[model samples]
Target chain A: MALPITSKKAIREWKLYIFVLPSLLMVGTFAYFPAASAAYYSFFEWAGGDAKQLIGIENFRRAFSDQVLLDSFATVSVLIVFNLFKMIPSILLAVLIHRLRSDRWQYVYRVLLVVPMIVPGLVTLFIWKFFLDPNLGVLNGVLEFTGAKSVLVSLDHFFGWGVFFANVPIGWLSQPQLILPSLFLWGFPWIGAVGVLIFLAGLQSIGQDVYEAAELDGVGPFKKFLYIELPLILTQVRLSLVLLVIGTVGGYGLQLQLLNEYGGPDGRGMVPGLWMYNRAFYAGEFGYACAIGMILFVFILALTFVNNRYVRIDK
Target chain B: MSACPVSAASPAPRSNARRDWAKHAIILFFILIELFPLYMMFQVSFKDTTTFIRQPWLPTNPLNWHWENWTFALRLILPYIANTVLVAVTGTVCSLVFAIFGAYFFARYRMPFSRILWAAFLVLMLMPSVVNITPLFILLKSLKLVNTLWALIFVGIAAGQVFTIFVLRNFLEDLPRDLFEAAEMDGASHLQQVVNIVIPMSGSIIGTLGILAFLNMWNDFLLPLIVLRDKELFTLGVGLIYLDGEYVKQWGQIMAAYFVASIPLIVLFLFTMRLFVRGLSVGAIKG
Candidate 1:
């Protein structure tokens, strides 16, 4: 029997709210409340857990004039350029795996590819630091073995930028000149299991009829990739791009600082997130840290809005 | 880069063989790049500290290898593994339980402010979690949870639950109405219908979500770093950092510790890639 539309019906509908209430309370306390409080803290001048006073945007004004903060933005921009380009390998690996004729080969590649994902990211970074070490590095060893060290020296002299030095020993993690470039080169070949899986899923959704039609016109592999696969997988590509943009710009730069390296080599590798963290935890300037965080949030929020508007895969 | 000639219906047999070789070569090259660093760490874990420093790339002489690193590293950090599992499991279970209740209700009922609340949750899901650090630390410290696993568990259950709820809610929304309607026709109450219909229907999704939450919490470095302080309370992520500090000059020991940190997740992935891949491919990372 259908229940009449009355107080009973209203009570049942509202009963569901009880189920949602705990979740709401938890999220409100942890995520939403913190976010709101972050905004509120931005206007105060508090330090070392002492009594506070209203600062009235002083921290933000300081953010504008802060040279270190400005340089961090530039450093992040350069790092982001490399991060964006890293998507190419992810796409390429996805395509290669998709094109494999054998099911066993596809399974093998998928399983093998996940190896990198399981390893801790920081461990991989640690290994890369060792791999690129100037004195004891594998990369430099290869250069010496191949007798390309002399060529690198000549090239470094020709460029006059100290950008390429094989025999002269490049400082991969030190030397402000090379640190950003070294950071850019982080996550070399950058294809992770998630990226490949996302792209493969996108590629698998394409109809065979489209490829068959192209084949009839004698479109080869390269043509098929360019005209068919690339366009079709634009959504997946966009998804990866937006994620990379956010991760590089807002999320990971703080990680570099947390490693206790702060800004590598004369502050060339500084980022706003790290600066915010330094202010809050190190300097005990919680209010200023919140203000700095608000500045970074504005940039991230703007980028996220732009990405959602322009780069949604579902569209 | 050239397309096939218009006159040709198919490539020549010799060129076909050549093409296969080229594709295989390229695939093999990428695979090596993927596997090389991992292999480097694994191989170096067998060397003595002195040998590793003097001849960094030398092949480990099986006879001369120092296997003590594994024993040494594990002895130091196995407690952290246990701690990590305790926190990760509790956080994941709580997240799943809360998500199941919240997602099912949100899916089945249109209560007041539900849409607005869900929209706000969605926006929070998209916002960079780095933004939450400053205030969350203060909040957790105020509650005296800073040096305990509960801090990570609570934060995870609160913030980490968004993805699980979003995924499960979408899955429930797509459920066939007839299934639940038939239950309603039988005079089953909403709770009974949910117990009978929703729980059983979402079994695979529950598996996917549970594994993802577990892995996410386990691999989490930042939250535990910010919250947990005592050496005894360190999860594997934080433990691995401390391991690095003690073994900074010992490549063999560091590599051993790294492998110790990596092995559990690797084992987990090997067994659960089917569910893991499904969870990943169905757009969990959309936000």
Candidate 2:
């Protein structure tokens, strides 16, 4: 043992690798190994077997031409549109809550907002699925009770003249045309609790002196928001934007539920991630799925990077 | 920064009483919107079939107090809950252990390849979960680990370590290093220091990370759905889906099932809400 004398420092540092190894191993197997394996598998064709044929970018070629992929892109654009729609309410609510007179009320609202997080997200979607049920939905009931349905019917009759659209008892999730807007309605008034709280944090962090300075200038609320508050909380907006991009693009929750094993009428509800999932496990096109995964990864990564560079609210 | 930084605190001036009322009203409206879906779920669970169908938005017959829905929902999902508990507990423990060790070293030590490795992990953390799903499914199948609670637990542990490690590393870095150095000067071994000093001070974060991990595993749907096919083997997430499959769009029953699945997390949230909110806000701000 004395023959090879290692310094205590060397031993101290070397032992650190032991601590590092378990994490690396876990992450390697699940995160890196799969990522690497996905990249590797994208080059080969396999259907749940050892025998893999070299496809040589055939999957990528097909993916571009695939009708499902094209349709998904279209649907994703719609999703993106609604996503932007969703952010406005979220930001407005954040502002509203942040302006509360009482800290106790603010605390109550904060807790109330986050209480929903305890419910599984998928379960929430399922609950909304019920709410979107054409026949027995509360929304339709509310429309009936409040006579909004009749108002809508008359408005549709006046506006459309039976040319393009009409008021109908719509199956929000099931209808091909209504899918996008219906999905929006399902998570309607989407005051994202996390978004609100994060914006509240950003709002709270704004220097009081900045506000006082703005007040001294006698700026109206709208002008103040446009000039001062907007600039200040732009960082939160950016963060929320990035998060939305990730959640919408990467998240399979909505598509997986609303579509419920298959894409909606005429594949209207299909998004890219769900399409990738279906291709992978259900279709057994491992190579194709991996290619899809890689494409999604690169797309999101590029989008995020571009946003960070060009669309930044804060440096 | 003294307490209440003058008129700058609230959004509107005190003199603008009308504006204050408007702001309060808007806040209430948004809160109602946020809570509406959840309210629908809870109120529906109490409604009888007819009442649920007719007056979902209205109050239920309070005297009736549909105990059957709770009983049915709880009974159906009890095994699933038990399975979830096993997975969540096992996964959370393993994740916390691995993260603690990794974070301690990453926080305290100056090691070769640390920067590169840390960067690699950071990049990996950012990579979307779906990107890894296909290959991971294959990997799991090949390892003959699919459809087991252990497999679910394994995946949870593996997936959760990234966040747990990131959070714990940041937390540990913020703590003063003097105590550890003192222990080292007293001829304390790394293990001894970790056991005595690190563990003693890390109760809150450990709790925070543990709850977060447990919540993640508990609420996970896609992974369990893909992995487990056997109804008995399924976790709550997958089980609830199968329940939904049986009763498509049955609001009361569906709501009941959801409430049952949600109870554990609700109780957990109740106890650890401060830590949970702080973790979320801090994570967002810092990231």
Candidate 3:
């Protein structure tokens, strides 16, 4: 039974395909093709050469066992933890802002919170770095004024504030232990800018009737949040989690800036993104870097899929 | 359920006072925490090394106001800003053009493989930028597009298309089908219909998409870092990093530079917050 196909229908279909062709070509050449090449490169030990030796799975094997890789994994895990800690509070703040009755006040807060997001990453990084500067930095000065020893030990030598406060400086950036936390402090406020915006959207979508019902039942604000608001906005929470996870794992560009591309103080703050970057560019370990990138891609894909499924189920 | 009497509905006066105090304290605490860092940045930007060290917490005495750092950082960063603007604006314009036409087709015609094409666009939207970095870098290098602003503009346009198309397609799909059918009945060509109808109706969506795309392109660091070898081609993100590395010890100047770089974005965000928020919510929630 041959299906009757009209010439008009066939021409219309062909025209549509023609319209989509340019976009497909662009995506294939720039995105899909490169993605496939990255996967292929992951399997062999080819370091920028016309001829390559085949080392099947050797690159992946080395990537798994490498100490630097392991360290980066641990660092990324810690970063994710800190990011959640920061992001949750920011979301709560956004919800609070949305709860305010005055639209004028809400706009003011939105503008202030959003300022950080617009700030160039370079500027934000430098401002925070200055704030934490051990010597002549404002943070140390505040600590000294509060009857505490200077946080920056180097400052004691330069300022000569007193012998009692002449201990080694906080060494915020130079110290490996402080590097991760310092980076978190520098980056956390910016998270609020985006988090508030997302949360504000979520809050608005929630039906006011739910809140009114809770109130009629003599429910407190906290109980209403737990029983209604929280459940309704779970989709936004999941989206945010997925975003934070990807950003944490795949975001090494900022670290390279703040930490001078060495992951700051013995590579304590080295993330997977930076690890892949250093491997490919600095060490010319193209195969290994691609393997790491593929692994990250798979992880992100799996997480996003899981998040989407979870959201669907909740709905 | 037991209902309380109307006379007993209100809380005790003492309890009300306590609740009011608690609310006020909590709000004040959070406001201070949020504003303090920004305040510190502003204060430090004006202070010299000695005074900043002597009283970091106190308001600047005599306000040294290092206006010179502004000029210095501007001298260092202006080229980068110009480059960023060029790439972001051009990329956004190209993306909008492709997305508008593509979305119009998807919404109007029930073409063969339409479902599959839509699904492909969605999947591409989920594909993270990190996954494409290495191959794209090599591809650009092979094309001899490295160190040029065009490399960034092209990539940005390509990368932004999927989401823009998705947003535009959704808006277009919600339009009345009869409107398009009537245009077709009047013998209007597809291009003419798009020009006469879709473009006019899509003003808000297009404007929103343009703003979002521009912001993303402006803030982007990784693509420029890889493709731009010449310092002059550096975007704001890369330029700031270069400046930071060069003057590692000059914390004041670095912060000052950051302050200057952030102002334009802040202004844009402040003025367009309502539109930005509305667009973000629509795109995010609908997806």
TM-scores for all predictions: 0.92, 0.92, 0.86
Calculate each model's fnat, 2 decimals: 0.44, 0.52, 0.32
Query: Relative to the unseen true structure, what is the Cα RMSD of model 2?
Result: 3.9
Off by over 4 Å in 1: A1-8, A162-168, A253-261, B1-19, B187-191, B246-248, B283-285
Scanning candidate 1 chain A in windows of ten residues, the lowest lDDT window is A252-261
- Of candidates 3 and 2, the better by DockQ: 2
Candidate 1 residue pairs in clash (backbone atoms < 3 Å): none
lDDT of 1 by residue, B197-227 (tens): 9889999989888887887788788778777
Over A1-315, each residue of candidate 2 has an lDDT whose tens digit, in order, gives 001224566575587788889988988887788899999999888897989999899999999999988888778877887898888887877766665555666787788888888888778877777777777876776777798777766776888633222346656676676676677776777877777777888788667676678777887778867886677689988887887787788877677876654568778788889889898878899999999999999998998899878887554
Misplaced by over 4 Å in model 3 are A1-7, A138-166, A188-191, A205-209, A309-315, B1-43, B47-51, B54-64, B282-287
Give one digit per residue, the lDDT tens place, for model 1 in A25-47: 89999998888989998899887
**Model 3 per-residue lDDT tens digits across residues B1-287:** 11112213455533433434444454446666666656666666666666666766666654457777677768876777778888888988988888888887677766666778778778776777886787778788788898999988888888888888887887898887787779989999778888899889888888888887888788888788778888777888778767766743554566566776777677777777766766655555443
The candidate with the higher TM-score, 2 or 3, is: 2
Interface RMSD for candidate 2 relative to the native interface: 5.3
- Give the winner by lDDT: 2 or 3: 2
Candidate 3 docking classification: acceptable
Q: Which candidate is the best by DockQ?
A: 2
